[model samples]
Target: MTHAIPVPLPSALVDHHAIDLERKYSDGWGMKVDDVATTPSGEMYTVSKIHRHTYGVDDDEADPARAHFGYSLISKIAPDGTPLATAVSGQSDLARQDTTFGGPTTGLGEDLWWARGLCVLPDGALAATGADDHTHLLTPDLTAVTAHHGMPHWREDDGPRDPFASWISTTPAGRLLCTTGEYGLYNYGDLLDNILAITDEPLTPVSKPTLRALACLEADPVKHTEADLRPGVLFAGEPVGMAHRPRPSLTEQLAKLDPTSRPGDWYNARLGRPAVVREDLFVVPVFGHIYRSGNRGGPFAFVLVTDQGEFTGQLGGMDRYLDSPFTGHALEIAADPARERIYHLNRYGLFAWTGSGDLKQRLDLEDKRFKPLRHFTLLDCTPDGDLVLTHRTQHLLLRIPCPDTLDHVGHAVENALRAYAKERTDLKKQWKPVTWHWVDNTAPVHRL
Candidate 1:
């Protein structure tokens, strides 16, 4: 017997033909696709937050009166965008009561919900970071979770800290590094965007045996609570005041969607909460390098880091000179190893660059060609070079087909930048930094 080779998928994605992923996998709840990652073989993995109730869900509700608690899920898809497997992480109380989620027997442990970060580890295991400062390692098959890495302290400073990791990536040498979202406070209320080394040493390249080893490892048991038996209260049993009335039921909200309703309107009506697109990091494939954005405070620039996790320099620090960090660019980057292409995503459009850092093409996704999808957050590239994107306001995954070749915009932008640089040099020659001396003339000044 012989195995048949699978036909290759199209290199570019079709805008109107995007996969309706959230509808099929959201399990009848509001969900926001947070982060996405792809395997070398083209498998797509997505992490999403599961909203249990309709709009207006609040955390101020009582314990048993659960309004909204953090819940999340992971889905694995084939190269062709077919759903293969799904693993959900949520509180035991909600999972048991809601048929949409798995119970205590589910593969993910407790408090593992609110997962916002995902990356394919060097060993091919999936590393998912969630609440309580933990990163859970699962088998490549998504069958069993092997390890729960509890981040107890900041690795760089070795200080007591708690950071919510929302972005994770791998280096070419097989090391896993993660960073939390920006605005993270460290010791003494200091804001530091700390990069965490998940693996103490570089991992061996992924092999079938190493992937299978994850399933064989023994995982810790999850402790269950007594709230498993009771259904969570979405509304207060007795009305206390006029201000705290129960919101409309899911069915009532669904009824508002008529045949003429636009999909965006329907989505907006049931919108729960928005998930922040955090700072992202990825390895530049063919070049075998790492590029990342600052976690929090910006002027955001992509910093180049070595495979061993040492800062080399800023890869896109020139943006600070050309564009204002305040209103200019909130750029997210994605790389295509198959074609050795790099992409920069910003508010206006997308810019494609070569592995050698030359502008290749520019795409404005806001154009009418990519209709109904606006405000795209650049995710990851599929193995076939399709750009994966998602609208923060919409619950759909959009893809734009990107072939190996693109219409060359030449070095016009580069030449223009050179002219800009020359003008800056002339301006700099006319100015210099000077120190100001101040003398206090007030009374009661003692000089030693």
Candidate 2:
């Protein structure tokens, strides 16, 4: 079915405001922010936190001396942009303290569970995944309820090393449908094989599959060709070495694999954590593949599966329409109950897909500053229809009223940045490597 193109909105619906939260809470860093639930009094609440270590790096020494403990910042923001009541987490006993890998520093607990992926249950209890390897249920007031670690079937040799993100959706029967992204730290062959299997079918009754495997697909590997091994002089501030190797084709690899075996069966034997989920349909952005189920729970299996060939075909069409290849990584998926539209953020831009997984509309925010150089890591839709997106170092909370709204905001932001740049000409010169912090390419940042 064909879908109508979405018109961009005007700039008036979009407002820009910054809170000097860092100044107020000097101990904490704002790592991620997510909208939880609206109160009966019409107040909006969000959960934010400061992570113990910088994203991506597993080592504690990689972070500066000041980065140790995690902190939680919960805020109730008023309609007029005022913070109602702010809550902090580090001073409490519920915080978990553990030493992370890669350094001698001790890691203090912030709200790591809340940041992974959170969903408010029908009973108003919050369900989230924790770094402690468990799922937590918390009250609306940010108090803990009960925690469940599931059955703990994870084996280190299985596949993924970390659980980057997780989501808990209640099934129609009230049981939880938990999905997690696998930590991306292993070999590509094992990682891809596991993800394809997980996306194909649900975990067995005896196995508890965490969502960490899915996150591995976002892993970016530096491909070096043989010529790159030779050192060469830099030209025009760019390295003059061998060209990078192109990513391998999944279609070609799949053709060589045994087709008779189930995707999971092959993955489970070699890879640790497969990207398997119990959902009716699953899509992996890293693999650029889509899998569907003909029926909900009856001998549920994969129907339509894509490989690099299909990925190239879809990208070819997208490039023709957008005048560039769709490079955006699909991070989060949100459903528009009103329009039945599935909105997701990718490396290229924000796109809306139909229920059948067909691309409907694309919001290209490819100006100079907002170019598709980095993938969008955080995405959420507000109750009032605003699309909030966060990138690396930059945060944008936009109200997408129409197509024009995106262009308006882009121009306004560019103009504002230009003015700021002019005022701080010396600011660019003062920049040093020490002033910059390395964040994982896949980590998300949001305001509380």
Candidate 3:
């Protein structure tokens, strides 16, 4: 019996063009342009990094000198790639004790909170998590309104650990729901390493493993009163990294522990996922998984949680076929109000899942230069359904149109492959060799 060879599909989606949104500054190293918002005037505003000057006194304490470094900034850019306005933060002249260099020096540097998240309220308020558990609320014009310093415990002793990520949504009761992730003191030391160390111990089954904090705050938009919005445990368990096990045929359990064991363990633990809000659904991507709930106030549960099966299903059952185990992580999600479509950028590709939980469309551009889906650390869908995506490397902002039809490309490819196979029996006769070629050259190439 001859096995039928499967053909790959062409991505139905095409890039319109890449828009250069930020000017007058370059993206800093490891700086992520997380979120974007539109002002009342229709100008696009983005949260990015900027270089600022910090002053430090000399060894003799004679005079203070200036040093320039990177800091977080909220910038407004025009459609034509012009910077309209910018508001800088997390920079001070005070000398910082540099433990790594073992000296006190004033220098512009990155703040831990900048990596966490930022969001714009419906009433044109800019809310961002700041250093020392400080939540800074600013007007639409970027003016500071109120600052809510987290509890003393959140900022005392070892100093406030920066928030991992934050999400903003309107509750059914007409309040703002702010969700944030806080790193634990013990777990704060190289998150990936600590998690791996715990996993290595066979006797020590992890009990009461606390995650980096995932807290929700309910704040009245008008009154500005804030209260704990989360119910029960925010994130109950610690995230586990991937570990490789030797094939049972190869090694026994005792032999697996040998120092020279074949097929070493593989682990890539990720926690503190980012959150996205679409109408009544609040979605969070954590530990190579996606979880969602309804609104903010009442009881909430997972709409579509991530698992090995779902991950494999999304990749069309190739997870097992590949040599490396498949891993899926959600970077951000975009919702189009006009089309009522939600776009999710996973580690795999850009997928458009329906509001009703149906996988509608997928555009697999994993090999592109500016893999918009892969590079998106922050994403937003405009009222018109256009996507505002921020790249991790370039820190470049992108505005792309979201397709109305979900999974249109996936369906088209499936149909095309079926039709091609049915119509061309000769091609199927040499199925093995021919199918490989077709999948490799799925997109039609016009030779001039």
All candidates' TM-scores? 0.50, 0.44, 0.49
Off-target runs (Cα >4 Å) in candidate 2 are: 1-30, 34-45, 51-67, 76-81, 84-87, 90-114, 130-133, 144-165, 170-176, 180-330, 367-378, 382-385, 391-396, 401-448
Please write out the lDDT profile of model 2 over residues 53-137, one tens digit for every residue.
3334343333334334454544444443233444343422332332331111211133343344455554555555543233444
Q: How far out, in Å, is residue 387 in model 2? A: 2.5
lDDT of 3 by residue, 410-433 (tens): 443334334433533544353333
Order of all candidates by TM-score, from best down to worst?
1, 3, 2
Model 2: weakest 10-residue lDDT segment is 1-10
The whole-model lDDT of each prediction reads 0.40, 0.33, 0.35
Candidate numbers sorted by lDDT from highest down: 1, 3, 2
Best by lDDT: 1
Candidate number with the higher lDDT (1 or 3): 1
Could you tell which candidate, 1 or 2, scores higher by lDDT?
A: 1
RMSD of 2: 16.7
| Model 2 residue 267 lDDT score | 28
Clashing pairs in 1: 12-401, 12-402, 13-401, 182-296
